[model samples]
Target: MFSDKSCVNATLISGTKETCSFFIFEAAIHWAEEGHRVIYIAPKALQSPPLTHHDRSNPSTEAFKLMRFMYLPNYETLVEQLVDLHSFASLPNVLLVDDLDNYIEDPGVKDKREVHIARLCAILLDTMNACAVILKQNVHICVSISSECEKIYQLYFDKLWKIEEEDDGNIVKVKQVAACNAANKTYEYRKYGSENIILKQILYSQN
Candidate 1:
């Protein structure tokens, strides 16, 4: 949804919990097919059934292979992965984190929850900076979070986009809520296929 020159230090995608995962996966697939090596990380188990059932274009075997899915059950594990990303044989072009709020709002961290969240945000920023300066790689990082958590996480991201469903779910609206150098814009899409799976961008307007 963003241009190649757009800063990728951090990008937040906020939407309803029901829609975040699907949209994130669609983005992962799209980037992967475009020759971006993608890494999709989530706290919960990602079922293979949904890949087959997804309404949009299904990924081919080779395209799907370009994506590396990691199931990190908790925030600690997620943090460890982010810290160790530089050790990878090859850096991924895109990194997608699903359900980021789940990690930040864990019930076990009843005390100093905000502190924990802030630390995670800092680590994410550090990772991005290290990738660009230390490793000389431009890795795009996107996180899917519930709208409620957008305020808490937005400061760490260079850009923020909010997604909403409209018109009995036939249309999807993507609004650029915040950005560093880009104008605030809104994009509307309509389901174009007989099954209503493919989303075609039909409108773009500056806000």
Candidate 2:
């Protein structure tokens, strides 16, 4: 789990749509069950309603909110979407973006591309950071990006995890690519069932 004022990026590399979807769904439920309001934003095609095991009838328990957007002619970028939902900042929330990389690519020339990318990055950073401040801490903003666009998002994340299938093809490995003055080793993926996935760090003995 991430602490307050933290922006974590998880790049799903070589993972199928179903795999990534399961992870996001699991995360949503985990956070929501812990009494944190969850706001999930993603494309319509990739959006799935989170399954909450908590008692929703209890008004004391927090609720989950799903915002699905279509990639239509009027589709807005992630920044635009977040700006509209800023009111939710009063609650301890976990904001999840399923595929931020979806909007990272735009056709343009060299100089133009660089400028466009900067603008996009600015919007994401500003919106999320503002929420972190307004929420008065304990707001987790998780962005799921493809490995292809990891470099672009790396600029704004406090921590980043890269997930890819192992060469043996029997498991997936997640590595912490960036951290604060710490070395992060590899974590092996373990699947107990379709919905239960765990990442256990591998420890090497110093001989």
- Pick the lDDT winner: 1
lDDT, model 2, position 86: 63
Error of 1 at 131 (Å): 3.0
The numbered model that scores best in TM-score is 1
Residue-level lDDT of model 2, residues 123-206, one tens digit each, is: 655665566566655456665656454455556555566667654444667666645566766668665433344555584322
Error of 1 at 6 (Å): 9.1
Minimal lDDT window, size 10, model 1: 48-57
Error of 2 at 144 (Å): 1.4
lDDT by residue for model 1 (99-153), tens: 8888887766665866777788778766655555544557778888884653567
Model 2 TM = 0.65
Clashing pairs in 2: none
Q: lDDT for model 1, please.
A: 0.72
